[model samples]
Target: MNNSVWNVTSNSNLDTLALSHSTVDFASHGSTAGTFATLNVENLSGNSTFIMRADVVGEGNGV
Candidate 1:
C-alpha cells in the first residue's frame, strides 16, 4: 500500500476589468486573417471529446 498526498490549484481570476475607450485607436497589425490549430490525440482512449474554444475580446473598433 502507498499513501501520498498532493495538492494542485490555479489562481487565474481577474480582480478588476476595464475596456478600452471608444476613441482609442488599436489595430491587428499581424497576419491574423486565417489561423488554425491542430492536436494529436493518439494516446487518448475511452469516451472522449475534443473541445475547442476561443475567448476573443476586440479592443475598440480596429480589432
Candidate 2:
C-alpha cells in the first residue's frame, strides 16, 4: 500500500481552534480493532476559531 496521509486546509479570519462536544471509541473485529470519532461544532464562523487539522477529530472528521 502507498502511504498517503493528508489534512484539510482552511482560510479563516480566526487564529485559534477548539474541539467541543467530541466523542471517540474503538471497535474490535477478531484480531483487528478500528477507531471512531464524533464531533459537533454547532457554530462555525470567523472571528472565532479555526478548523483544526488533526489526526483524530472524533469519529473521523475530515475533508
Candidate 3:
C-alpha cells in the first residue's frame, strides 16, 4: 500500500489492520471515530509513511 488513504468517518472500528508495503497512509484519521485495536505492519523498508493517531491504536477487542 503506497500512498494509500483510509478515511474513517464515524462509527468505524477495526480488529486487526495488517498492511505490508513501502508506504501506508491513514489520512490522519486517528482523531476521528475510526480506530483500530491492532496494527500489523510488515516490510519495514525505506521511505515508509504510516500516519495513524496514537489514540486510534490498540482500541479494539473492547479495549
Worst window of 10 by summed lDDT in candidate 1: 1-10
**Which candidate model has the greater TM-score, 2 or 3?**
3
Q: Write the per-residue lDDT of candidate 2 for residues 26-46, one digit (tens) a residue.
A: 221122233223334455433
Question: Can you tell me which runs of candidate 1 are displaced by over 4 Å?
Answer: 1-33, 51-63
Lowest-sum lDDT 10-residue window in model 2: 23-32
What are the runs in model 3 whose C-alpha is more than 4 Å off?
1-23, 27-34, 56-63
Expressed as tens digits, the lDDT of each residue in 1-63 for candidate 1 is: 012211112222333322222121112222354333433323333232223334356746755
lDDT of each: 0.28, 0.30, 0.47
- By TM-score, how accurate is candidate 1? 0.21
Better structure of 1 and 3 per TM-score: 3
Q: Using TM-score as the measure, which candidate wins?
A: 3
Candidate 3: C-alpha lDDT: 0.47
Question: Cα miss at 42, model 2 (Å)?
Answer: 0.6
Candidate 2 yields a Cα-based lDDT of 0.30
Decide which is better by lDDT, 1 or 2: 2
**Candidate 1 residue pairs in clash (backbone atoms < 3 Å):** none
